[model samples]
Target: MRNPEKKTEIRIVLTSDGSSSVFNPEFNQHYHSVFGALQESQRIFLELGLYAAFERFEQINVFEMGFGTGLNALLTLLEAEKNQRTVTYTAVETHPLSMEQARELNFDTLLNCHYLKPLHEAPWNRPVSITPVFDLVKYEGRLQDFQTTNRYNLVYFDAFAPEAQPELWTQEIFEQLAAMMQQGGLLTTYCSKSSVKWNLRAAGFLVEKHRGPAHKRDVLRAIRL
Candidate 1:
């Protein structure tokens, strides 16, 4: 269970891209990049991660490590609606934002979409169709406690930085994710630290560094082998 005291401390902050992101003082981290929240999700998770998976798989099963603000899921839902593809998105979040806090985010206004409300309002621990093409199931717990029978084709590793949550970036966690993914599945994250790259490789993934969004220099994309 998340500390209620910590949950109350979450604040909404505007990113460089004019998107609103949650700032958790507990970890001293922003849910998205301070540079640009929307830009980061669109470029890294949607373009690099999901679109790449779409090429090989008829239907995409996506597992997200952090579902903060639901930005990635919203972007993915938009793509699924546009391309008419089927997507099953499962997100694990230990401390979720309240609906009031979720409503305060400007993602919908920035993206000119209305799915953000439904995405947040959707019930937890059950599949809910946000749209005909997109089905979402959110698990309200730590990633370690998350269990799923479905093997994901694409994973958005949007966890807080290593300094904030080192345990989640360990080889053990990467290995667990590797076990939950299909062969050749792709995992994309904003982190490209040497330790993170080493852990991914040690956990049986082929790691590659790519140009990051906005102010970031490089990000990582790993393939399960």
Candidate 2:
């Protein structure tokens, strides 16, 4: 369980791309990069994570870690519409944002999207259709406790930096996730630290480096083969 005292002090921060993210003093980290939230999501997750897999498969199943602010989910939902593909998105978060906090985010107005509100309002632990093309199931629990019978085609590993939450970036965690994926499944993250790449390789993934978005130099795209 997340510390209640720590949850009381989240601050909203505006990124360079005119998108809003939260800064958590407990973790001493911002939910998205300070440079640009939307750009980071699009560059790392949408373009690299989802679209990269779309080139090979029509419909995709995505599993996301740390679904903060629902930005990546919203972006993936938009991509599903653009490609006319079906997307089943499942996200797991230990400490989810409150209704008040989620409503305060400006993503709806920024992206001209009305579904952002409903996405946050959707019930946890049940599959809800944000649109006909996108289906979302959010788990209000930690990833370690999550058990699934379904294997994913892609993974958006959007946790905080490895320095902040080292447990989530370990070889055991990667192996666990890799076990739940189909062959050739892709896992993309904003982290490209050498230790992270080493651990991904130790867990049976072929890691590739890619040019990152602004302020970040590189990101990782690992394949479970």
Candidate 3:
């Protein structure tokens, strides 16, 4: 289920304790909050999927499903910096976070153990180039409405769980995403549900399960064959 209350600023939903249910706390902050979900997303999607994919792709393009709060984008910047890789980050966010709140999240701490006060302070929707390391460009839209003109090296399919957002897991969306991937491009998601796996295959991917991050058992890693 979706979050009951929408947070206009940070674009976060309050998650229930150990449940996927997102709700706004009476005091604010979603059920899962910022630090917990974003950190886990980085460890699983970027550290494992995006980073690994970049090793083989010289000019990497990343399409993220949810730009919720720009956490994944921030992590991608740091990862690109450390790996010294060229990345063009294209992210979709129907709900973009506010600059003031994003600044409050202190993303600078995530930048190479050093304080990148500039990145932390960069306003949302502003594409910033950290150079051969990172070039972030954001498109503000719903994931379902995205249409790509170029093939991407990797797709961080980091949307909400299929149970939560079934529309995102449909074969139609997968087919569109498949059209945007170069041969051998990979789509990584934190979900390993059987239906999700089947849908991806229906869209023409070679889907397989992989080790997930903390608290999760398995994740799906799909490659264009």
Candidate 4:
């Protein structure tokens, strides 16, 4: 069952970088940072998350905690194109935005990438080819129900804020994610709380606090060791 707290209305808000993010009334949280949605996604998830692992593997597998607006996935797709790499990305979201809600996010025109339309239109729970280089599979379910059958090389831990959804940032969740990654796999998030860093350490990850994107001070990048 979907968490009752995540069932609230989602409203679109423009971020600092002229990108739009969804604000959830229940948690009083924004899917991406209020600083700059595109800047945050590019810096945290792409630069630190995907690119950090891309050089080591010819073909990579990625798992995202919450696929919210599909911004991270879209950026990853663009990176794959630039590097001539292949990525199989699987994203799980307990609460997804409707087509109407998704269209409100102007990423397609902002990034000059027209593939965003087919990405949101693709059915859940099935892998679809977004491009010859990027394959995507989206699950309409909670992370607890997720079975780590396909190990991932990189993890986009883009869940709600730790204060709002503390359960998702626990040691158990980190352990589950660690078990799903290959050795030296990278996990990145825009969270830098001390407790979160400690939990990642307990989960056997070598955690590092990196300089964050605009407005934010620090973020996290952990490597499975």
Candidate 5:
């Protein structure tokens, strides 16, 4: 059974089959590290999306919908260190990764050595200074009710697929995300569904299609203009 959170209504489970993935009942697919999951996250969201968005924010606020394996958070911290940029990262995961599950991820080969532990060991909801340039703040909450008094420079809407969780991908949700983003800020996601693009437009984002990484034809990158 999945634990419930007030802000988000995501249900997550451990595969327990030595597959190294957190299962999403909605998508019927593991969220992170199921099929080269962390690598794809690093390539799509961090290296391609967040780092590019960082060019505009000396101080970045990242609102991540699903913390999952904390891979994106880890990658962001590493990128911040290399770029001399500072990040205030906020991630939401109702069901977080256990120590055993975290260890099984084997991201040590993909990421350099220094980031392995801090990425896994960072305490939940407690703002920690993982590096001089990176500040981590996690919340065990839901995405629907994640209200911030402030706005973010980047938004990673990496929730389960819209089909699995329609609640997270609604016009209302996109409207909320758009409202919480800073002017001219960016939002990126692996999904490029027509309904998603339409909802983004309805929420006031200027959306564009971009070349996706290996085996993916396209991705959506939207700007809050």
Candidate 6:
């Protein structure tokens, strides 16, 4: 597994919507869109991915490609609590933030939600229940090396931009992910690149281009076939 601490430096940066995101110096990437981190995550991952999945399944198994800053997981946990929906969320990340780094983010302050600390502090490689309806399991390692027997109903493909991490956006990776999803399962990502769309198609997903949040023009949502 890649040691992000040795090769990368992270800094907190404010987005347009008053949320903070991590900026990775090695990849020249921010964890979320610069236009608005909260907005982007809410619209794409939560609204388009999780909520949509909940409409089709009573119990949801969500797999996240990147768990940077824990914004997406925290938001999902809040949503699950509000609706009393059962959610089993599993996320894989090569570089998890230190407790101090997680505390520096302003998501809890901005969202007025107090679960960020618990979400970040949850133990790795084990299931932990932050709330009655929400369970989380975080894996600290590379996506390519991660293994899971759980078939996910929803996926938040929140990796860095393709320009930064081309390997993660390829057909092989999508094929591997496709094998782990159930039929009609949903996968959403912030990127709308043609290569990404094509790769998803090649991996046996029915792809659609959706209106993105904030400054992004388009995002991709795919269903497993």
lDDT of 2 by residue, 1-225 (tens): 444343546888899999999998888999999899999999999888898889967779999998889999998888798878999999998778877788888888999878788888888888999899999999888888899999998999998888889999999999999999989999999999999999999999999999999989999999997
Better of 1 and 4 by TM-score: 1
lDDT of each: 0.92, 0.90, 0.67, 0.90, 0.75, 0.91
Off by over 4 Å in 2: 1-8
> What TM-score, to 2 decimals, does candidate 3 have?
0.78
Which has the better lDDT: candidate 1, or candidate 2? 1
Off by over 4 Å in 5: 1-21, 24-27, 33-35
lDDT of 4 by residue, 1-225 (tens): 433344447899999899999999888899988889999999999889887787777679999999999999989998888888999999999778887788889999998888777888888888999899999999988897898578898999999988899999999999999999999899999999999999999999999889999999999999999
RMSD of 1: 1.7
Flag the better candidate by TM-score, 3 or 6. Answer: 6
Give the Å shift of residue 76 in candidate 1: 0.1
- Clashing residue pairs, backbone N/CA/C < 3 A, model 5: 7-142, 8-142, 8-143
Error of 4 at 71 (Å): 0.2
**Model 1 CA deviation exceeding 4 Å by range:** 1-6
TM-score of each: 0.96, 0.95, 0.78, 0.95, 0.85, 0.96
* Local error of candidate 6 at residue 171 (angstroms): 0.7
User: Where is model 4 poorest over a 10-residue stretch in terms of lDDT?
Assistant: 1-10
- How well is each residue in 37-112 modelled by candidate 5, as lDDT tens digits? 6656766787657877877776889988888877677778777878888888888876676665666665565565
> Candidate 6 regions off by >4 Å?
1-8
Error of 6 at 179 (Å): 0.8
Instruction: Give the better candidate number (1 or 4) by lDDT.
Output: 1
